[model samples]
Target: MMNRARITRVGALAAASALAIGGLTACQSGGGESSGGDVTITWWHNSTSDPLKSLWADVASEFEADHPGVTVKVEGYQNEELQRTLIPNALRSGGGVDLFQAWGGGEIKDQVAAGYVKDISDAAADTIEAVGPVVSGWQVDGKTYGLPFQYGIEGFWYNTDLFAEAGIDAPPTTLDELYTAIDKLKAAGITPIAVGAGDKWPAAHYWYNFALKSCSPDTLKEAQSQLVFDDPCFVEAGELLQEFIDSEPFQDGFLATSAQQGAGSSAGMLATGKAAMELMGHWNPGVMGGILKDDAGQDDATPPEFLGWFNFPGIDGTAGDPTAALGGGDGFACAQWAPDECVELLEYIESEDVQSRFGEIGAGIPVLPAAASSITDPNLQQVLEGLQSASYVQLWLDTAYGPTVGGAMNDGIVALFGGQGTPEDIVKAMQDAAATL
Candidate 1:
C-alpha cells in the first residue's frame, strides 16, 4: 500500500504543472525556427512526476540527437483533461499537438473512428515484434496506432506488517481463503481491504478481475469487443463483486470517498498499520514514498518502509490461474494531422535505448523485454515478474469498453456499492449497453 497520487487524476486546467514536469528546453510557437533541422514535432503527455518525466524526456533527447534536423516540443496534459478537450481540438483544429499519449483499447478505437489518430499498424508491426506485449495490446481493427510506453500488472498490493499483526500467514490464494482472511482482519479490528469506488474505473477493476478469473482469455477478449455483458461469466463476476462490497470488510466511508481521497486514505491506513491490504498498481511506490514521508516530517535521509504486493488470486474453481494478470498502460500516439517529423519523433520514443533510459527512472515497465531486463530497480523487477508469468493479460475495463459505455459501467458499480442495485442488475445494464455498441 503506497501513499501516492496518480498524475492521471490531475484535472485539465492543470496542464501547466504537467508541462513543467516534462522539462522541455525548446519552446516552439506556431511559427518558430528549429535550431538545426526545419522539422519540429509537438509532443503531449500526461505525466507530471519524476520517472515519467525523465523517461519521456530521455526519449525526446535521443530523438533529437539522432535526427539532427528534427526537434520535439513536448507538452504534458492531465489525463482526464486530455480526453475531454485535447482530443476534440486535435480532431477539429489539429493544433493541439502532433503526438500525445493514449490508452490502447476502446479509447484507441473511438479516437481512430473520430479521425483524430493516425494508423500506425504498418509502422508499428515490425517494431512490435521487438516490443512484444506492450505493442500486442494496442492493436485494433487489425491495425496498430501507437507504441506502448508503459505497462503495469494489475493485482493486490498488501501490507506485510499488517498481515503479520493479524496472524495471517500469507495473502490468500483462493476465493474461500480470501473471505476468511478478510474476516480475520476484520476480527482484528482492521479493514480487510481498502478500495476506491468513487471513480468507477477502480470499482470496475474488481468486476473485471473476477471476469478474468472466471472466463477464458478469449471469452474476455470477445466480451471486450462485442460488449457482451450478459455472458454468465461476467454475471458471476458481478455477483462476486457485490459480495465483497456488501460484506463489512471494506473500510468505512469507502463509497463516499473520491478516488484521490480513497487512495491517500488507503495509503495512510496501510503505512500506519491500520489496514492489511489494498488493490493498486505499480505507480504507487513514488506516491507512498513522497507524500507519507513528508506528512510525518521524518528525517529526509531515511523513510519508513511499509510496502508489499501480490497478484490477484484466482477463484478456486475458475479455469484461470491466480497468476493471470490484467495488463495495460498509456502510450505515445501520432496524430493523423501531424507532419512526418512528428511521426518520426514518436517512432524514436519506442526505440530500445530510449526505452531503457525510461526504465532507469522507473517511470514505467518498458514494453520491450530487452529494455525491461536492463532495469535494475527491485520493485520494477517485481512488476516485470508479474507480467512475464501472467498466463493471460486482461486490459482495463474502461479501456476495453471505450468511453461512453465504460462510463455506464462505472455508474453501475457505484450504484452497486450504495445497495441501490444488484450484481445481476449491474451486469445486465453493462450487457445491454454492450449490445448497442
Candidate 2:
C-alpha cells in the first residue's frame, strides 16, 4: 500500500488509498539485462514503509551477494500508482519493469491475457506449492502467474482504550451491535470510525464487507467469474452500506482524509487516538506504525498498545455465511520479457528463511505455512486465526472482479459514500464495465 493509500491482497486492507496519494512519482526503469554471464533483476513492490521496505532492500543485497555476477535492483512505490499506473503502463509499453507488485485476481488475469506477464507455473513450482491454495488468486485456468508473500483477512482495527471510554465492553458481533457501539462512541464524544473516503477502495470496502455478508459464498464465487450482478444479495449489500453511512459514524470531513499519509489519514486517525476505529486489512498495524514514524521523523514507531481488532460484524438475516471473510494479499509477478533470474528472485523472496523474517517483522501475515511460527505479533496472529477459522474467504471485491469492473465498482461505491450514487447504480456500473470486456 502506497504509504497507506492504495492496495489489497486483503493484506488487501493493508495499504492506504491509491487516490489519496496523487503525487506518487513513477520511477520507471528498464528491466535490467546484461550480457556475458552478468544478470541484474529489477524488482518493484508496493512497500514504501519500514520493516518491509528495509527488508526488501536487504533481501536484494543478500541475493546479490549470494549469486556472483548478479546485481538486483529493488524499489518500492506507492501501491495504487504502481499497481494501477506504473506497472500496467510498464507492461504495455514493454521492457520498462521486470519483477513488480502483483495483486492477483482480475489484474493478473488481464495481464496474462494481454501477454504481458510470464507463465510462472513451471518456473516457480516449488514456491507455488509452498504457498498452497492462496496462490490461486494469481492463477488463471490453473496456470500460475504471480506469488503472494503475505495473505490475510479484513477486519476493524480499533482502539481498545477508546472502546473502554465509550463503554463498549466487547467488540460487536452483529450489525445492530456494531451500531450500538458506534452510538456509544458518539455519546462519549468520540469519532466512531475513520474512513479514507478520499481514497475510493478504503470506503468501498464497507460495501465489500456488506456484500460478503449479504451474498452466499457460491454467489460471490460465481460473480468472480461471471461479473454478473443479477443477484439481489448484491443490491442488498449496497443497501446495508447505505444504512451504515446514514448512521454518521465517521470522523468529520472523512471524504477528504487519505488512508496512510501522516496523522490526518484514516489510518492516522486511528494511530493517533483521534478516532475509535478503522476497517482495514492485515497490514494495518504496520501502516499505522509507518504513519506515526513518518510523522515524528523517527527510526521506528510501533502500533499503539490500544490497538485491537475484530472481524466485520455480521448481518443476521443475510444469505452469506456470518463466518465468511473478505481478503487479499500482496504478491509479485515478472514481466514477460524479464530474464530467468526474475523467477529466481521471486523464489528467493518467498523462501522459507526470507518469509520467516517477513512474519517476524510484523509487516503483514506471511503466506507460507512453514513460516507461521515467525508471526509473533499478537494482532497479526489473530488475523491468521481469523483466516484459518473463516467458513470461506472471498478475495477483495475489486480484485476478484478484475480491473475494469472492479475500478467501476470502486468508483460507484465511493460515489455512494459521497452521497452521489445508489446501490443499484453500483451494479449498473459493474455491468457496463464488464460488458466492455
Candidate 3:
C-alpha cells in the first residue's frame, strides 16, 4: 500500500474541479441511499490469508447479527491483484464494491477526485477523533473519507540467529556498519537481504528509504505539494540504492521473486531461514507466520524465532534526520454508491475493543492509541516504538504522490535495480510524469 508524488497547484485545482463534479454526479445517482429491500454491503479487502481473513468474516457476521435486513458479504483478494487490477477496474466502472480497502494517501485522493468514494466525516466523527492525527492520510480539505484501522513504519526484519552466525554482535546503526554487516553475511554464505524486486513496490521501498535519509521532511512535503523533484537529494536516493544493488546482496533470481507469496518469496526466504533479513513494514511477521504454517495449516514447530528489527541505517552526510521514517496504513472507504451501513461497518472495525482484538492477534500495528498495549509481538513493538519516536514520518512515495508520479518513480527504481536505468533516470521518470500532472 506504499507509493510516491507531489502535485502542482494547477493539477490540484484540476483535481478539485473533477472531485466536485464527481461528487455532484454521485449524489444525483443516489449514492448515499440504501436499497429499500434486503441490503447487501459488499466489502473488499486484501487479507486473503488466515487468521485475518477469518477475523474479518467473524466481525462481519457479528455486525450482521446485530442489524436486521442487512447482509455483509466479505470478499478477499491478493494485495497486488486488488491494488493493480481489481480495485482500479471497479472504481473506473463506478460499481462492484460498497466497502473496499483503502491506503489513505494519494490513492484515496485520486479515488475521491474520480468520485469513486464517499466522504464519511460526519458519520465517523467520533471514530476519527479516537484515531487522532493518523487519520490525516485519509482526509482531503479537512474532510474524512476513510478510517485507518492499522498503521506502522517500515524497517529491516532480521533473524537474530542469522546475525550471530555471521559474526555480527548487534544490528547496524549507521550505513557503514550496515554495509559491513552485508559483507559479513555474504562471507557466511547467507543472502544479506531478501527483496522481492519482482514485485516492483517492494523494490521501490529501498529507494524510498534512501530518500528518507537524504531529504528533510519539509523538503519532502514541499515536493509532495508541488509535484516537483528539483532537489538533488531525490537523485541521490537513487544513487544510494544503486550502490546497494551493486553489492549482489539479494537472493538469486530476485528479479522474479514475489514479495510475500509461498516459500520462494522474500518473506518466505526469511521465514524458512534461506536469507538473513528483509526490509518490510510492521506487517512482516504475520506474513512470515502464514508462510511458516505446516501442511495442515498448523504453526510449524520451528516457526521463525528470535526475530528482530532495526531502523533503516542512516547515511553519514544525509540532510534528513536519521530518526525520520517512511510509512502508511490500511483503511476502508465506502464507495460513492454505498449505503450508510458501510460507514457503520468502518466505525465498528475501528472501535477500541475491536482494534485491541486486532492487536492481540498481531493483525498489524493498531491505529488506536489505546490498543498499543494489546500488542505483544516484540518485533511489532519495535516498529511501534520507532514510529512514535520518528522526527517525522513520510508516507510511502508512491502513495503520497498519487498513482501517476508514484508509478513512474517505482518503475524507474526497479529499472535501476535491474541495471536498465540510472539515478538520473529515476528522477527523470518522476519529473516527466509530474509534468503531465
The candidate that achieves the highest TM-score relative to the unseen native structure: 2
Q: Clashing pairs in model 1? A: 3-287, 3-288, 4-287, 37-69
Error of 2 at 368 (Å): 0.8
Candidate numbers sorted by lDDT from highest down:
2, 3, 1
lDDT of 1 by residue, 191-244 (tens): 888766655566667877887887777777787867776567767777888887
1-437 per-residue lDDT for model 3 (tens digits): 21111124235445645775655432233334555566888898988666677789999999999888889999777776667656776677667688999987888888898778899999888899999999999998898999889999999999999999999999999989999999999999999999998989999999999999999888899988888899999999988998999988899988899898778889988987889989998888888876667322455322467689999998899898899988999999999889988989999999888899888887689999988899988778889999999989999989899889999999999998888978999999999999997
Regions of model 1 farther than 4 Å from truth: 1-40, 58-71, 121-126, 260-274, 293-304, 319-322
CA lDDT scores, all candidates in order? 0.68, 0.87, 0.85
Candidate 2, position 258, lDDT: 84
Ranking by TM-score: 2, 3, 1
Q: How much does candidate 1 score in TM-score? A: 0.83
**Candidate 2 overall lDDT versus native:** 0.87
In candidate 1, position 145 carries an lDDT of 80
How close is each model in CA RMSD to the real structure?
5.9, 5.2, 7.3
lDDT value, residue 227 of candidate 1: 78
Count clashes in each candidate, considering only residues at least 3 apart in sequence or on different chains.
4, 14, 10
